[model samples]
Target: MSFEHVFKRIIEFMHADPCGNFRLMVGTDSQVHKRHTVFITGIVIQNEGKGVWACIKKVVVPRKMTQLHERISLELSLTEEIVGLFTEERKNELIEIVLPNLYKGATFTMEGHIDIGAGKRNKTSEFVKEMVTRMESMGVEPKIKPNAFVASSYANRYTK
Candidate 1:
């Protein structure tokens, strides 16, 4: 299969699989050189989905690797900065360059958090508010619910 087909299939499997738990980790194999190769580790674990999910939760790189890891982190962090600095048009331009590889796990990790954490403050209510705001922005009005219910839903889906 072509890379696009393989990528789509993997995403579909992750979304549709009833008994599989998958997590993706992005990193580089080597960092000493300029043209570092990006690596993606897609882990699948199926153990009533609990222990398997934990098993897949391992980082390939240690915290000590600062030079390249930090660089990648900064680049990832810059996405929202660029978005904030430019209007929607310029932001879309920047996204064109940056977003193509984001699913493959290339960008500053901060980008992910900023994309998720904008209006959400410290409280759980704040988190729901932020999520709802995003869904609204996407023309999706989600039903607001309590954290306990949301946690229970996750527990139900993943736990046996």
Candidate 2:
């Protein structure tokens, strides 16, 4: 579906009084093959009591992402590219219309869920802090690991 259409659907879902409350999340994940790679970007709206609503799109990169940092960068870049479709004015309109109190003093755009996280055996842990820092600098809120289901779960599924 078109990005604008998908975005509108998300806004509509948000305004539908979804079991009282909901959080909007977006992210990307990738699966590498010997000669190519597939990336999946997803948007997930988690309602307080009603079930979840989601959408996804997949694209292929000609080259494999063999390096950890390279993979992380591609995931982050793809997600950012998708999110770029959501203009600031429109996002604020949704916040004003449906999620006024939810974000309080925050910027209130879709939360980005990065696949990187902290842990001993998790190599992606090394990029967690750096990725969070960069995303914050760009005025975005980022989540990872257990809280990053939009990327680690939703996006990862279609990447396979």
Candidate 3:
């Protein structure tokens, strides 16, 4: 979908309950196939426990991506690309919706969910610091593994 359309939807969702807590999450995951690889990036807006509006953008590589590091980096790059679309002006617009309700406990957070984990059993563990640093530099809180449902779960489901 176009950025305008997605932004419209997000505004509508936040306007529904300006006093509600909201989280805007972006994540990407990739699946290598016999002939190609599919990458799916998920953009999710969760109004705390109230409701959510989400979408996915897909990118397909012409050849199988076998290098683990390369695949992981590509996934993160895709996620960052999406996050970058929400420029400061656009973010301030979203925040403006809830700004008045801040005194009522309203809050907003933007998170980048990396599919990698720090667990010793996970091969992606080795790259956690590098990826996490990249995400932190983006000015969004970074989440990995069990906490990164957008990349590991939502985006993963569509990579196939």
Candidate 4:
């Protein structure tokens, strides 16, 4: 779907219950095949314990990406591309929905989930700092590994 349509849906979902806590998360994961690689970015809006509206954007690279660093970086780049679509004006629009209800515990957070883990056993550990820094620079809270369900779970599922 187009970015406009996605934004409209997100706004409508938030409007449905402005008083609820909300998390707008974006994540991307990839799978490599002999001929190419498939990347899937997941956009999810969860109204904490209430309900969620989600979507995914798919990109297929013409060549298989086998390098650990390259694939992970590309996944993050794809996620960033999607996050960039939500300009400050658009983000403020979302935050404005729950602004009035802040005193009542209503909240809104933006998160970027990187499909990397900091475990000694994980090869992606080496790049965690770089990816996290990028996300922070974009004004998004960064999540990795176990906490990054959108990337490791949601988006990963589609890569297959």
Candidate 5:
């Protein structure tokens, strides 16, 4: 109903099954006529085309709520469609395509759910380990720095 509420729901769906496709409500806020505010509901896919690339093949949003029960039916049908797309063979192909790209830097930053300066310690450790291994294989060294340190260094340059 509200922006924050909707955002919470989306996050919940994302966390429930980090590896599966899920639906959540999205909306935009705008004012019409001084005080008549309208929130347009929409949908967005999270973690789309991520690990294994098994995701919704397509999504259709209905603009009109002609029937009260139609919304539930649409949601159920869409969920099934998404599940069907994530076949085992597709998942294997996705991994084959993705893993090689990781070593080549072609998909290092393009994928991964890590924030600029936030994530679980285990993920960070694994990333560092993989990067070091990959770089060593290619005869290159990695450049490592804490995000806050980097940000402060840049900020100091502007102040001076």
Candidate 6:
């Protein structure tokens, strides 16, 4: 099936609101290879920390990345695609279903988990601030390090 179909399925699941509380999470993780880099993005529908429904997309670059800016640019593009998958109309409908009194519309919380963290001495640390800002600017909440399970754990699984 196409990504659009998959996203719509998830959105329908959200509209059902069966689990009482649900959280939608989006995150990306990448691994460097000798000649190329493997990038994976994970979208998760979490059920109040009890369980989750997840999907992932992967892409492999043709060459190794040497610059932080270049790597971040690629991440940005992939992140945008994931965020853009949900249309405002569809999202509002789902939210309205969950919150009937939401005449002004509904608000759903999405956290974009970045694979980079400041707690470690890694290349990603230098880019933490930039990534946090990038995520905020895109209207998605940002998470990093141990708190970023969807990216660091869920998406990281597909990178291998």
What is the lDDT of every predicted structure here?
A: 0.30, 0.78, 0.96, 0.97, 0.31, 0.75
Reference-based TM-score, model 4: 0.99
What candidate 4 gets wrong by more than 4 Å, as runs, is: none
Q: What TM-score would every model get versus the actual structure?
A: 0.22, 0.87, 0.99, 0.99, 0.24, 0.83
Give the C-alpha lDDT of model 1: 0.30
Model 6, 8-119: lDDT tens digits are: 7776766655434667788877777889998898888765645667888888998888777677667666876887766686566555555753443334567888777786
Where does the lowest 10-residue lDDT sum fall in candidate 2?
Answer: 100-109
Candidate 3 per-residue lDDT, tens place, 1-160, comes to 8979998999999999999999999999999999999999999999998989999999999999999999999999999999999999999999999999999999999999999999999999999999999999989999999999999999999987
Q: What's the lDDT of the predicted structure labeled candidate 3?
A: 0.96
lDDT of 5 by residue, 1-160 (tens): 4434543454454444444432221211111223222222123333435422111122334244343234323432333333333345543443344354444432211111111122455333434454334323432222233432211232222212
Tens-place lDDT digits, model 1, residues 1-160: 3433433443444434333333321111122223332222112212234332211111233333445434334322332222233345532442344355566643311111111222345333435454445434432223333322211233223222
C-alpha positional error of residue 131 in candidate 2 after TM-score superposition, expressed in Å: 0.9
lDDT of 4 by residue, 1-160 (tens): 8999999999999999999999999999999999999999999999999989999999999998999899999999999999999899999999999999999999999999999999999999999999999999999999999999999999999998
Total backbone collisions for each predicted model: 2, 0, 0, 0, 0, 0
- Residue 81 in candidate 3 has what lDDT? 96
Ranking by lDDT: 4, 3, 2, 6, 5, 1
TM-score of 5: 0.24
- Residue 6 shift from truth in candidate 2, angstroms: 0.8
